[model samples]
Every structure is written in C-alpha cells, then in structure tokens.
Target: MGIATVNPATGETLKIFEPLSAEEIEVKLALGEATFKQYRKISLEQRSQWLKAAADILERDQRKFGEIMTLEMGKPIKSAIAEVNKCALVCRYYADHAADFLKDVPVTTDGSRSFIRYQPMGIILAVMPWNYPFWQVFRFAAPALMAGNVGILKHASNVPQSALAIEAILTEAGFPAGAFQTLLIGASQVESIMKDDRVKAATLTGSEPAGASLAATAGKQIKKTVLELGGSDPFIVLESADIEAAATTAVTARLLNNGQSCIAAKRFILVESVADRFEQLLVEKFQALKVGDPMLEDTDIGPLATPSMLLEISQQVQETVTKGGKILTGGQVISDRPGNFYPPTILTDIPVDSPGYSDEFFGPVALLFRVKDIDEAIELANSTIFGLGASGWTNDPAQQERLIEEIEAGCVFINGMVKSDPRLPFGGIKRSGYGRELSIQGMQEFLNVKTVWIK
Candidate 1:
C-alpha cells in the first residue's frame, strides 16, 4: 500500500509516497547498525550539543512543524504548536540531564570496586501513532540518541509527511545520516524489520493490539520492547470537590486532542450529591465548545484523524444509547459539512454492559456515572481493563489520601487533570501496556545496565 496523507478535515488526498522496497530497507538497516558503532563512541558533551541544536531548530521553526502536524493528524492548530514546543522542551531536558542519568553508579559489591554502567544497545525501532506525532517521537529519540542508541521510526502511514519532517529536523540539527531515519513503509513490513539482527530493541505508542504484536515478535527474538498503549482513564469527583472547578476542567480533560489521547479522561465517576450539578455544568461547557477546521486558532475541537475513527466512536455511542444510556448533549455526526467533525457528547444513565461503561470512547464523548459514595466511586473507577492515568477531585484530606492510594493506575492526579510531564515517569498498567516513558525511567528503557568490577 502507498503511504499517503489524506486530510481528515476535507477527505482529500494531499500527498502520497511509495513504500520502501526490500533493497531500500536493507540499506537503511545496515546504515543504522554501522552508525551505532561510531555514534556510541562519541562523547556525551557532543551529543548534548547536537540535541540542544535540535531543540533550537524546533523552536525556530515551530509554526512550520506545527502546521505539518495539524494538516496530517487534524489536531487543533494551537495544540499542535504546543506539541512542537513540548517536543523542544523534551530535547532540551534530555540534553541537559542524560549525562547525570546515565553516569556509572558505584555499587558496594564484593569485587574490589563495582559499578553499574549504562550503555546504548543499538538500533531501536519506534512504532508511533499520528496523534501527538512530534511529541511522541522526540520523547523517545532525545534520550535514545543521548544514550548513544540510534532510532528507525516506522510512524503511522497517514502521517508520512509528519514522519519525514521529524527526520529532517534531526538531520538539520547535525545528527548523523543513519543516527535517526524514518522508514516510509506499511505495517506489514514491521515484522520483517524487527526480525533483522541489526535492530536491537523496539518501542511503541499506539493501540493494544499493535503493542501485543510487537511484544510477541520481539519476545521470540528475546529483544526488549516498551509499549504505551490505550487508556479509558477515570475522572472522579466526590462530594467535597469544588464542583465548578471540576466541571470546567472536565471539558478540557475529556476533549483534549479532539479526544484522541490515550490519557484523556474517558469515564467520569461522580458521587450522587454532586452528580446533577456536575452533569449540568459539563453539558453547558461541552455545548460552548466550537467544532470547526483544525487549522483555525479559535477552534476548540477538530475532526478525528480518520474516517474509521469517526465510525468507531459513533458506533460506540449508539451502542450505549441502545443499551439504556441517555445522551445529554451531542449524539450525531455533523454531516452537513465535509470532514469527520464530531461534536462534544455526553452519555449518562449508562448500563453496566454498555460500551459507555466498559469500552474506550476515542472521540469527543464523555461517559458519566453516579455513585453513592467514595467507596462506590473508587470501585467503579478501577473497573476497566485499562489502568493508565486517572484524575480525582476532592478537598477532604482523608479522601485525598484514599484516592492517591486506591486508584489502580500508573499515575493519579488529585484536584487536577491527568497529563504527561518530562520530569515525571509516564506510562500505564495492565492492558494500557507495559514499561514507562518520560523522565529517567524512560531513558533507561532501551539501555544495557552492565555491571563493572575493578580489581
């Protein structure tokens, strides 16, 4: 299949490219392996300088890069620019911190003097998604390259231009030709690429099925894999929470990235006392949101990345409605205009077996649940198979402690929205996928933790 960029807003094909042939793939693989040998010997200071330069480029041409992302993936223009800026921040973060993060750790072992040395493994394969394209890749590449490992990106086919732009950014920043390359190939080609001996490990940020396939393939080779997959994160509001604040945040929390984000709050569990007021506030806020072209600065929500995404979320909402759920706001696709525009939606009185209660709704849709107390809220929040990220709003110190301790997620935000930060470790648990990304833990994911002993 040809790799192409089809505008989600207009359903028009803007650009297309041929997938790499077997011969081309072989050459890139060989080049990556060869580059790793020499790149690994380069000093930390040099790598840091190159990474800093990459950050500079990102900041200098952020609007250009931001437009590429908005056109390819349909994220709002303002958010797209923010994503590029975040990518630059991560580059600078790793550039300044990788040396300390990877420094030898002196250990008190039996050998006269023992220490743990962190070293690059080799060429790493990154299977990334179209959503947050720049942010995701840079978060992986900055540390991977800083630790001396090279990267070969097999980005989502629909975002080919975005993918190529990333390689150009790194190359312009002075990274070696093979130090970071973008593979313009289809998903069918990933298996063969991963099987190659030159590719040492892999990292993926996408769906659960994709993550499972990569992990299984790498498991056979005994090569490592890190996955950041789907999430149906919970947003809990108890009786003590400031209802006004929680509802305002709930709008943005549920609809960020047009609701394509894995960590965007999908399920909202509220105590019965505040449920009515919170639901009213949510409906007003959702209705106030503007749905239009992603390229517009004032647009609050945009099209789903693809038509299939629109169909899937529509079906999910219909299923919930069929199973006794009530639609408090939007429930239909905006068909008068072109593109995959979906209005912000809310579903309440959801049945136990409905998609609203169990499945992840990857669009501008929110599922609301009411519970009698915090006990029921916590129990309902942990019901899903995904334990990625969760947000809890409460002022009572007792409830705050309980929420922090009881939520079955990798990270829980009290009185705030769930988000990923460069300074903190980010990932999920259970079906949300294994391993971590961002911070010190992320940089170490593909490194070899070798033990050194001195006589």
Candidate 2:
C-alpha cells in the first residue's frame, strides 16, 4: 500500500499505502478538470440536493466514520463522533445557503443592466490536515462543491482512510466520478499537482511552513490560495469575569484535540486580581481529567496524534520550566501507557522574554500569564505571531467592548470559548494565515466574481 493507516491509539502500523505515481496523478488531474466542466453546469438546486445527500450519509454512519478518525489520529471516540456530526452540519449549511450566498449582486454601473456573477473557477486542490480531519475537509468541500467547483483532496498521510471515506460519501451521494476525488499523495507531490493548468485554485489548513510553501508555489503560477495555519490563541480572563465559568471553560479550551488543535488556547492570561483563583480552579480541572484510551467513552483527553508530537510537547514544557516557568499541576509523559500520552500541565511565572512566551505549545500544556489590568491583558493577548482567534472573558460592558475592538484576531469570543462556526467567516491575520473558510465569504474564495453588463 502506497498510502496507509496506522492506529495512533496503540502505536501500531495497521496498514501501509503507496502514494500515487506521476502517471496516476495526471489521470486524476484530467478527470477533475473534465468532470468540473459538466459539474459546474449543474444547477444549484441539483448540487444542493447532492450535498444534502452526502450529509445524510455522514449523519447515518457518523459513528462508523468517527471510528476511522479515532483509529487514525487518536482523538477521543466521543469527539471523533462529534467531528463527524459537525462535518454533516457544514455540508447541510452549504447545501441550504449556497444558492442565496452565490446569487448575483446587482452593480450600480453605467450599463442598463450589470451584476456580479459568482461562477465556479473549476478544479481546486485542497491540502487538509489530520486534526478534526472530517470537519476541516467538509467545511471546505461543502462550500467549494456547493459553489459548483470540483475538489481534489490531498489529506494528511496518516488519515488516508478518512480521506477515501470522504470521496466515497460524495460518490454515494451521486456526485460524478471525478467531481470530488481524494489523491493519495505526499507533500513532495503537492507542488506538481498545483502546477496543473487545469487546477484553478488551492487551499490549505496546516502548519505555517506548509502554508508558506504552498502559497509560494501557487503564487508563482498566479493561482489563488487560501491558507489557514497554526494558532496560539489567547484565553483572557479579566477580574470582572465569572472566575468559576472562565476557569472551567479554560480546561476544555486548552485540552481540546488533546491540545493538538491549532486554535487551542495555549496562553492563559489572567488579570492579577483573579489569577490565583483562576489558576487553582484550572489546575483542579486539568488534574481531574481522565487521560487514557481514546476509545473510552469518558476519557477527557486522548493521546497526542504521534510520538513526535508527544516528545515535542514534553520538550516545550521542560523548556518553559527551565526558563523559570513554574508547573502548577501535572507535567511529563504518562509512561505507564502504550500510546503517546502526556499529562495535562500548567505553567506560571513565565516572563515575556521566556521561550514559552511566544511559542505555540501544541499539547495539553497551558502557559499562564498574570496581567495588571485591561491594558496589559489586551497587550499580552496580542503578543504572539498568531492572531487566529481569542477568547476575552469579562463581565464589564466597557471591557467587553474594548476586548472586542482591540484584540488582534479574526474571531473573538467575549465570555465564551473561541471556535469555528459554519455561519461565521473563519480565518486569521499575521502569521496565522489569511482567507476566510466558511459562510457567505467562503463560497466566493474560489469563484470568479465576473461582472456581467448588458447595455
């Protein structure tokens, strides 16, 4: 097998796969371009119908699909199922709103009749990551396909089964043979795929380096690219916030996806007045979490997706400790387990110049920061290169308003956790990457907004 699946939960090489050869890749390129020609012509009503059918398939066998994700990437079985359901939600959302979102917008021009038509730009290459594997792909696929643009997915090598499963769903939903396809390829093969003249645009959700590589290659060709990269989102808790609620939610925010999530709240910024209480509550929550087999129904945190990820996280924690950061709760690996497991750890006394201060700790480790006031809290929140999302906890109306306006992130949640919603535009600024991925704006990313004038 050129492309294969490995069980992350047990550290077992369950299967191996061979990547697609150049010749096979060429056939897929031809197939996608040719299929898109007819697929784009299909009416929006028909496309919506097919997308809904795909959603139905996902919802009906969500547990089955969830198991594949869990087996591949080590997400807890419950969260894996939720990811499947969320994929269906995005598909249904795009299916229901694509028509309205893409309808012609009349232009005020010299011509008697002029409007902007959002027409599909043909084949798109999607390089999706393994975290929330199903959700990430579907969010892009739902909008891209609903807008009449065909997609070819080059999903993470570890989740090839999930990738193929997605293609199967689209086919079972009656999409044409090549309307949506999964290419079993590697990173070295992506640039060549994007080089195809028939491939109109490309989108990626992964690390900063990967995004830069794809964006650079696609830029040379002048093809459009949307990159959603890594994030070290700030979870700010002001003195006025509900300390109990904020602390409780902080645990979930940091440990989400076993802290593998790009949008996970790595920095916990608490105002000095409430720092001690928040830290105490948060530590309690973290320690109480059940860390074990992802297949277990009640496990709060699962193993990191891979051994390297586990080691990287452990090193980050130790570096923080070496640089004067104090561990308030758990630290180090849980060696008793077979899979890649790490204890939920919290750190404090980390100065601004500390190595951990600006790094995105992509694990179940939290770096705590104590702020003097609203001004300092806002400054600490925007300190990192990542501006993907932020959660500002405050009860004061004026403070909420300030946080909402001053936070340098694409999406901000006041008194709540930061997350992606199918209805809202999702993306980031600075090093976090650009381009929206959901809602009305997402559907237009790969479309030709042509101006039609009838004088």
Candidates in order: C-alpha RMSD to true structure: 0.8, 1.1
Candidate 1's C-alpha runs over 4 A off are none
Cα lDDT computed for each candidate against the true fold: 0.94, 0.90
Task: List the lowest-lDDT window of 10 residues for candidate 2.
Answer: 1-10
True-vs-predicted CA distance for residue 234, candidate 2, Å = 0.7
Return the TM-score for candidate 2, rounded to 2 decimals. 0.98
lDDT of 2 by residue, 275-320 (tens): 9999889988898999988988999888888888988888877887
Q: List the candidates' TM-scores in order.
A: 0.99, 0.98
Candidate 2 scores a C-alpha RMSD against the true structure in Å of: 1.1
Tens-place lDDT per residue, model 1, 261-308, is 999999999999999999999999999999999999999999999999
| Number of colliding residue pairs in model 1 | 0
